[model samples]
Target: MKILIAEDDLASRKYLDKILSQYGECDLTVNGMEAVEAFLMAWDVGDPYDLICLDIMMPKVDGMRALQAIRDLEKQKGVAEADQTKIIMITALHDTEYVRNSFQKGCEAYAAKPVNTEKLIEVMRQLGLQV
Candidate 1:
């Protein structure tokens, strides 16, 4: 499974990459703009990501906007809603608003900061990803 990990924090990103790499190829992005660009580029090249781990408070664009953009892009490409790439919102904030907005924007899951490897894997499995 191809995956994208978008986070501004170096350590968190690396930790996620290290653990998730066991599953498949992974791409890293520092901020939301890069995240969206990477996602679009992959789609354009017919190599769309299977999963996206997006951070909420990134530079340039925020995760909520990024999620909306990705969903919109999928729709523009005639990709069905059910077939859109899976997204997991990863952030430090536990605010109900963020969670609600993320789900409203089409994220498949949400992971709070200091992410748990075991729980993340469980969520991945629940999403039908062979992790």
Candidate 2:
């Protein structure tokens, strides 16, 4: 399975990519808009990733907006039963509202900043991914 990571911090992005690499192929992006672009590029090339991990705050575009766009595209095509991409928000924001919004926006999970590698592993397990 392929995974897409959207993070602004270079070190964090690299870390996530490294960890996820143990499981499968990984793609890294610096921001949400870049994540969107990468997703589109992959899809256009007939290869959609199995997972997308997004950071809440990012330049150009934010995670919430990017997720909405992806969801909208699915709705637009009227593929009501199409498999939806698994989205996980890996962000620093801990506000309850942001957490609430994440679920409302269809994220599979949300992790607070200073991410725990073990927690990530657990979450990936729930998603049927092993590391």
Candidate 3:
């Protein structure tokens, strides 16, 4: 499975890559805009990520906007929205409203900053993807 990771933090991106590498192929993007661009580009070439891990606070195009854009594409292109192609939102903020909004917007799961590896593993298991 190909996993796409969108995070502005270099260290965090690398950490995610390292953790997921043992599982399958990994793609990296610095910010949400880049993430969407990369996803679309890959899809256009007959490749799509099996999962996307996104950071809410990013330099260009935040996670919310990026998610909206991707949803639009999924609709426009008539692609199925499946839990198999999961989306995990990551943020440091403990804002209940934002978390609620994200879940409503169809994010599979949300993780607080300084992620708990075990919890992340559980989330992946729930998504039917394991590392």
Which model scores highest in TM-score? 1
Task: Report the lDDT tens digits of candidate 1 across residue range 1-131.
Answer: 99999999999999999999999999999988999999999998999999999999998998888899999888899998778898999999979999998999999999998999999999999998987
**Cα lDDT listed for each candidate:** 0.94, 0.84, 0.84
Q: How many backbone clashes does candidate 1 have?
A: 0
Candidate 1 ranges with C-alpha deviation above 4 Å: none
Q: Which candidate tops lDDT? A: 1
Which candidate, 1 or 2, would have the higher lDDT against the true structure? 1
Clashing pairs in 1: none
How close to the true structure is residue 56 of candidate 3, measured as C-alpha lDDT? 90
Clashing pairs in 2: none
Rank by TM-score, descending? 1, 3, 2
> Residue 113 of candidate 2: its Cα lDDT?
76
The better candidate by TM-score, 1 or 2, is 1
The C-alpha stretches of model 2 lying farther than 4 A from their native spots are 78-82
